[model samples]
Target chain A: MLNIKNLKVSVENKLILNDLNLKINPGEVHAIMGPNGSGKSTLANVLSGKKGYEIQGEILFDELNINDISVEERAQKGIFLAFQYPVEIPGVNTNVFLRTSLNSIRKSKGEKELDTLTFLKLIKEKAKELGIDEKFLSRQLNVGFSGGEKKKNEILQMKLLQPKLSILDETDSGLDIDALKIVADGVNSYKKKDNAFLIITHYQRLLDYIKPDFIHVLSKGKIVKTGSAELALELEKSGYKNL
Target chain B: MKNQNLNINQEYKYGFTTDIESIKAPKGLSEESIKFISNIKKEPSWMLDWRLKAFKRLKTLKEPNWQKPKYPKIDYQDLYYYSAPKSSSNKPKSLDEIDPKIIETYKKLGIPLVEQQRLNGIAVDAVFDSVSVATTFKEELTKKGIIFCSISEAIQKHPELVKKYIGSVIPLSDHYFATLNSAVFTDGSFVYIPPNTRCPMELSTYFRINASETGQFERTLIIADKGSYVSYLEGCTAPMRDENQLHAANVELIALDDAEIKYSTVQNWYPGDKDGVGGIYNFVTKRGICKGKNSKISWTQVETGSAITWKYPSCILQGDNSVGEFYSIAITNNHQKADTGTKMIHLGKNTKSKIISKGISAGFADNTYRGLVDINEKATNSRNYTQCDSLLMGNKCGAHTVPYIKNKNSTSTIEHEATTTKINEEQLYYCNQRGLDQEEAVSLIVNGFCKEVLQQLPMEFAVEAQKLVAISLEGSVG
Candidate 1:
């Protein structure tokens, strides 16, 4: 339930994404694979409503144009972007941040907010499923976390927020094999008929875990090729040069 | 997205001036003004003489200019030194007799001046302008042998304690502002805890400056007797004025043998406007001494307001095995200027001290941390640890750290650490992407940075201080 038409993005007058178009329906998974300098990450950033970018064209979620929405509003409207590198916010406890984020979205959606005890109970169950220590939630947010832990934490947030449209921007880059499987399992279990995912990556390894319904190759800021799950394995063998 | 509305009234919520008739002393800083103050308070001859002595020294003490901020010379002859609400001419013997308007003013400020509406366990002394209008839970405090009263009342009733402890820590000729405060100081809180006793409740003083062109000079004294313990809190606010106002206060604390004194301050004076045209010039002197063996003293402050803030809450470790600690969080935004820190002096053997300071600068403000640690020759085996951290929101603001450490004994050890960091844009974006606005994100990150210092405050004050930290940084982000 997401649509992008002729989306052109630039920063500091340098074009990053050029004439990009994509669409994802409910219950579907789409993968965009590209080589270095291809606009895969740019597409993710543009969709999340980041500032300081010169953007053109339109992006629609559920037939509602969201190009003019703020970042927080976009998040409240069920748009989630998993960053390539999570930030280390010292002094902010992970649990508190999670609660604040959850309650803010809940308030915007006119839903009942969870109290501390209720939130703790829900978070504990989710953390256990993802193999996260309870102690990490009490510490500073991602201050000294390892690479794998950060990716796991990202997935935990994804599961917690339960956003309708999840954009995974290089989520599998720093994860080990076990961690990658845990992330894939977390996403696979949450995949519902009303939710969609846009997976952006460089390798075919992650696709082996969570198969995509369709795959598109992005080259020099445009989509150059489209195929099914087989395209990822083919590109991994032949590389983008022969695409 | 909905249009974000910026409410200007919420910026300085305490900027409303109370409209009331006031009786003011003749404008000027002279022997006559000091005498007028002493006469109105009806002080004893000895107390008047003490004030006169401080006035004599103030004449020769030129205002110090070593601070980072430089302001226009204050015209002492053109400013009123004392202004009190006319309704307080005859002190109220009961809460019912107090002026209704004065009580209403305190009510609007969220202070419970009446006994029926008291804040559960904390005893408050509400000082309006130059006079203390009401002190809550006085009789209850007296039941536990805790002497909590206005300094004016202390001079008349408990002269012995006042005469002995007054100027004992800071002295009359300490410096420019302290000396001036000693000379014409009209009213503040005084507290005393008897030996072998822990105070039953927190003692707090709320100072409000409601008169225009009148300098607020308050003197606070607190003493913890042998083996006794006490905690005191002080808060200040003023109306938004177009002309700069002066607030020079002196606070002294003494801890006797095995005694401990914890003092905390939440200074939220008016910081002028965004253009920095007017605000309070808060120059204060606060010092505590660990006088007897094994005594301890600690200072905690959250400074968020004032056009220019210049204060150093210090401690002198004079007893063997005594300890001293300073925890401070100073925030300057929207053209505000602050130069604050603490000093720890070790004079006894095995004395120890620790300091933690966090300074946040936003808009075009400037924040500085100036601290000193001195270990005397006799203080063998003494140790000191210090940490200073600064956070800046934008490139237009500035933060500075200046630390001076001196150790005369070879056996003493001193450790110091300092860091300066700009607010991480990525962190803000992360929080924003998770559903928080820019302001909320900034507040979350800032509160985390000041967590160490905010923890030192009492539970009730800690919550308020956290909110104040957020409000101080409102509209700071671009």
Candidate 2:
């Protein structure tokens, strides 16, 4: 679903991601395990079309170059990035944000947008599955929310938008075991043959709940090793230093 | 790049003018001019004398310069004090007799004066230029013993009520702009709710300034009798002009024993071109008095237009247990400037007041909130709460808050909270990443910021105000 060819990223004369090449097909789950300062988050940000990054090489989504596309266009084109630290937007209700985001994507896809009542019903079911309270959706987006709640809210948005390529950037860092399972369940249920997942994490704990098709170890802005799901368990015992 | 983004190209939608003959008083302000206006309205001798007294006081008062915005000097002698549509000379007794051209003007402005096309459950008084041409649903209002008519008509028919309440809340010689309004004011709405009765519908007045080089000085007075209730709204718009136009208005509201009054304003006068070539200078005085026990008065305003605005809609809590509230959202974009807030004066014991103000500044504009909360010695146990928040869009714009508080009684409490926050870049990116464009993201964020004040507006107007808030901040994002 997503193709990167020697993607290099730099900010203010400092190189973050150097000569990174990766490819993921439909129905595939790829996990990038890296140590601190290995530029895992930078790869996630660059894929989301964040500004202030001097990029080199090419990014292709379904064989179309999206290097010039804006952040919103990328989102509308079914590219979703779950932030490590979700922004706390004061005063914007979570439900309203989700509806607006969903409608925007729908409009771009030449589909009829859902009305308020229909949207509420759909979002309610999605929130229930993610173990989120209905009251949280009515409150300001992520404002004064617990770490677990914020992560769950991000997953709720990912499910609502139904993006083809979902990027999870350390989404399980602050989640408890129970919350982690709910989040994994949310992803497991939504996985389809036409969609894909790119999970970037420092720990292999989340991989226990949701197994990945392939695990890649990234070191110093380069992928050093690639293996099956058993590689996560082996790395968890031996660590990235021995890779 | 930021300057290019801030260069807004949206046209002022209500800047069109209608071509029609007008009977204008010669340009100048003098005793003769006041006499000319009074003669045109055919006022009683006592009313004329009172206007002359105000005129006499206006001559001795100089314009106040305490506001933050400073403009070029205004020559009172160069502005046409009164300009009315010539067809309105012979007042129409019914809709058919009124001039079709005048009615067409209001129709184009989205305010249908015709009987069948009138707005449902809302009575409107359409003021074109310097005269009130029509007031809808008059008969139905009269059935409930509610008096709703133009000030000119009220002076001629309900002289007793007009005489008893005129200048009661706002004295004739209170200040410069107010004194000027009292002297040369042409026409505005006047409402009176009878004792023990509630106004059945919303009463509104739409003011339009179609004549160039003319000043619109309108006076509005609303009185809610003992145990009565009323909600009144005022909206104003002016055609685009190359030379700056002046609009100085005075509004007074009074609530008697156990009565309540809710006043709202959506002022959308022309705010000049983006480069600040021309626009309206809006200087208005609005004050309400809670004159008896348990009375209440609330003021809600959404001010988005005007080159420079200076107004403070205040409340005088004179009755024990009375309540006062002020909810305002003031937006200034381009080269516009606004200095607005409210005043809460506690005079009786156990009174309470609340103020919520939201100011937004975009482009090269400047927005300020200046308020006063005074608790007198006799106002024991009285309390006041004020929250003022300002949102700035770009570095070129400015937002300031100046609050003055005076508490005399030991038991009285005053709580004030002020915050100034800039639009965060991360927030915008987050919204964008959720599929909302830049403009939509800004609008959503701003609407949420002003939600508290927007909820205070009537349902019909809240939606319009919300859209205006977004439109006012257009092109402000970089």
Superposed by TM-score, candidate 1 places the C-alpha of residue A172 at a distance from the truth, in angstroms, of: 1.5
lDDT tens string, model 2, B367-432?
999999999999999999999999999999999999999999999999999999999888888888
Which ranges in model 2 have alpha carbons more than 4 Å from their true place?
B1-8
Interface RMSD values, listed in order for every candidate: 1.7, 3.4
Worst 10 residues of 2 chain B by lDDT: B1-10
Give the alpha carbon lDDT tens digit for every residue of B93-158 in model 1: 778878899898888887888777774788999899999998889898899899998899999999
Q: Give the per-residue lDDT of model 1 (tens digit) for A35-59.
A: 9989898888878887788889989
TM-score (C-alpha) between model 1 and the true structure: 0.97
User: What lDDT does model 2 reach?
Assistant: 0.91
For each candidate in turn, give its C-alpha RMSD to the true structure in angstroms.
Answer: 1.7, 2.0
Best by DockQ: 1
